[model samples]
Target: METININLTNGYSIKSLCADDFNIVKELCEKCSDYYLLIEGVLPSKKDVDEIFIDLPPNKSYEDKYVLGIFKYDELAGIVDIVRDFPDAGEWMLGLMLIKIDERGNGLGRNVHRALSEWASNLGAKSFRIGVVIDNHKAMKFWSNLGYKKIKEVDMEFTAKKHTVNVMRLQLDE
Candidate 1:
């Protein structure tokens, strides 16, 4: 697997997270468990992060999936998972993105998103796709503000709950 290091506008950086960074990844997930619980009705565990680093997603034979650690001045601030050429050609999937509890509502989310967008564009992605729980009002608003539009709603089984997932899409600037 190739390690990617991306520097943000501020001192924040998105770096490749590996098995060795389990603790930091676990902590970041714990900080996001509440949000996941609110929508998926289940708390995220360290094992979830373990699975991503240990096993690759289905239909992906190579290492195109990236579980990145978002760091701000050496402290892990969040985590994100991005996949290239998923569900469609030339499409990038923002599979998972979560900001630390205390770090939300401070414009950090936007920074992380912008940095991800730029990184994907640099890698030749023509569009971005993300799935959001239908009832997640805040997330829907947040993504919409970032220029992603609700394209379709599909049923998704997440953590024991069957959710109506709003598939949002954003056509990147070419």
Candidate 2:
């Protein structure tokens, strides 16, 4: 696939992530979702993060995966992974999203979310699914405000731990 770059209103850009960017992307995920690590009872490690991405869920299949790095002034600012045509017809999985620790609550997420939604819709997708950690209030609200409604409460096992996952979807068929 060709490298696609999306420029945000806030001067950040999202481009295809390469293998060499894993470390910084891992650091971004760790810092943004520190709560996950706390609950997993393990500190951050390259292996842990690699495992999560390397062997992502079935919906996030190898060929359909689009791992994008959010960049700002030549630095990694966030990451987004998308799996096209997953779990259902005309739908895609918004697998992972993480912004830098210092960049939260500034409308950056909304811009990124909007860009991705538009991108998917243009690609013929009808909806997008996101699995939100049920108890993460910030993330829950963020997804909700983006018009994603919780459709189910699913149990998920990740990194050897079980937790409730709120399966949410944003309809793009309008």
Among the numbered candidates, top lDDT falls to 1
Native-to-model Cα distance after best TM-score fit, residue 13 in candidate 2, in Å: 0.6
lDDT of 1 by residue, 8-126 (tens): 86788889987789988888877888876876677877667776565545687447788898899899999888888787767888888888888889898898888878888888888
Per-residue alpha-carbon lDDT of model 2 for 56-160, expressed as tens digits? 566445667788887886888888888888888788988778777788788888888889888878888999999998767888899998899989998877664
lDDT of 1 at 97: 84
* Residue 62 displacement (Å), model 1: 4.1
What TM-score would each prediction reach against the true structure? 0.91, 0.89
> Clashing residue pairs in candidate 1, if any?
none
Q: Report how far residue 93 has shifted in candidate 1, in Å.
A: 0.5
In model 1, the Cα lDDT at residue 154 comes to: 96
lDDT for model 1, on a 0 to 1 scale?
0.83
